[model samples]
Target: MRMPTRILLGCDFSSAPTKRKNIVVAVGARQAEDAVRLSALHRFSSLDDWSAWLAAQSAWVGGFDLPFGLPRELVETLHWPGQWAALMAHYGQLERSEIRRQFSGFCASRPAGGKFAHRATDGPAGSSPSMKWVNPPVAWMLHAGVPRLLAIGAHFPAHQPIPERTPPRIALEAYPGLLARQLIGRTSYKSDEAGRQTIERRQAREQMLTALLEGRTELGLKLDIDTAQANALVEDGSGDALDAVLCLVQAAWALRHQDTPGPGYGLPPDIDPVEGWILCAKRP
Candidate 1:
């Protein structure tokens, strides 16, 4: 039997989206077992706009570049609700300042080199600790992003039950850095600061894009993009578009494994419900 095509989305999210650094979503679909075709790229200048856009989508399987859940150790230590849904609800009510205060206190109590608690997926995925509020500010990403997902009632495999609806809107936590590092190994490929956007970063972006086009990654997927799309990804300098496409590739991998025997969407069978796993991230 032929399977229907599913729209795949890869979001490079921003906690405080603005006209300058808007959220970027790469829209695409799997063309074959080893290839994905980029159809469009959408940008939203505000969190409300992005949330509304996501809510309006009929169906899709997306890999979003945001932490879906906080670390279990952090949650337990803070005595927040241990359940994922309840925890998210509690977290949504707290102001960002309070969150920072608490997380800061938690860090102050811990020893050097281990200030932040980590999720199991963080190590293998090479993701920042969900509790970190600076540098990448993923904690803010979770604050701004997850509530919107819950508001739209998107299905998160293992963490949230699949809806009974005919066409499901699925979301998976994804980190483009994981795939980028696999291809370029710690070479910086992007910088939001214009002064830091050097030719070397552009070269690095090109290198990763070439690897994706050649199907050289372990995910066994190739990216089919036009010259314009390729050039845009490399020239943007922020790498938001490229990161979204990288996430799109991961979403494609998850879609291919959506019917696997253990935990659909290529997630680990033992994935923590309170601390969700990243799609296609290797188990440690």
Candidate 2:
């Protein structure tokens, strides 16, 4: 029997999206066992608009570039609800200011250089702690992103069983930086500030794109894009477009493993319920 074609999505998210910095989503489908075709790129300037778009999709496996859950240690230390659903409920109700205050306090009480609580997957994925509010502001990303996923009732296989639907809408946590690092090895490929979008970063982006097109990465899947799409990914100095494509690739990888035994979707079997795992991240 032939395998079914699966819709794949990669998202480069912004916690507080705006006209200047919108959330970018790359939509594509697997063309073969080792290839993905880029179909379109969608940009959302508001969370509600993005949420609506996600709800309308009937079936897709998305790799979202946002922390899905807070660190287990942080949740326990803050005395938040331990269960995934309840913790998201409590977290979604809080204002951003309160979250910043509480997280700041948590960091201040701990020793420097070891202040942020980490998820088990963070080490292998090289992701920042979800409790961190600044720098990358992933705390805000979690606060904004996870609630939307929950509201949409998407399937999170690592945290729970697949929903009994004809075709499930699946969301997997993804970190684009993890994939980018595999190609560039810490080279900065994008920057939001115009002053920082130097020639070096552009070259790095070009190099990474070349590798993806040439199927040189460890994922063993080649990206198929037209010249226009390729140019757009490189021209957008913010790197949102490229990051979205990276997430799309990860989603493709997850789709390939969806039927595998155990956790399916390349997620670890022992993934934390309250602190979800990043898809495609190696178990540590």
Global Cα RMSD, each model: 2.0, 2.2
Error (Å) of candidate 1 at residue 38 is: 0.4
lDDT for 149 in candidate 2 is 86
Clashes of each: 0, 1
TM-scores for all candidates? 0.96, 0.95
All models: lDDT? 0.90, 0.89
> Which digits, one per residue and each the tens of the lDDT, describe model 2 over residues 1-284?
33344579999999999999999999999987999999999999999999999888877899999988888898999999998888888999999999989998998999978989998989999999988888989999989998898888787776665554424578899989989998899999999999999989999999999999988878889999999999999988999999999999999988888877655788776778888889778986
Q: State the TM-score for model 2.
A: 0.95
lDDT of 1 by residue, 172-212 (tens): 89999999988999999999999999999999999999999
Lowest summed lDDT across 10 adjacent residues in model 1 is found at 160-169
Over 4 Å off in model 1, which ranges? Answer: 1-5, 162-167
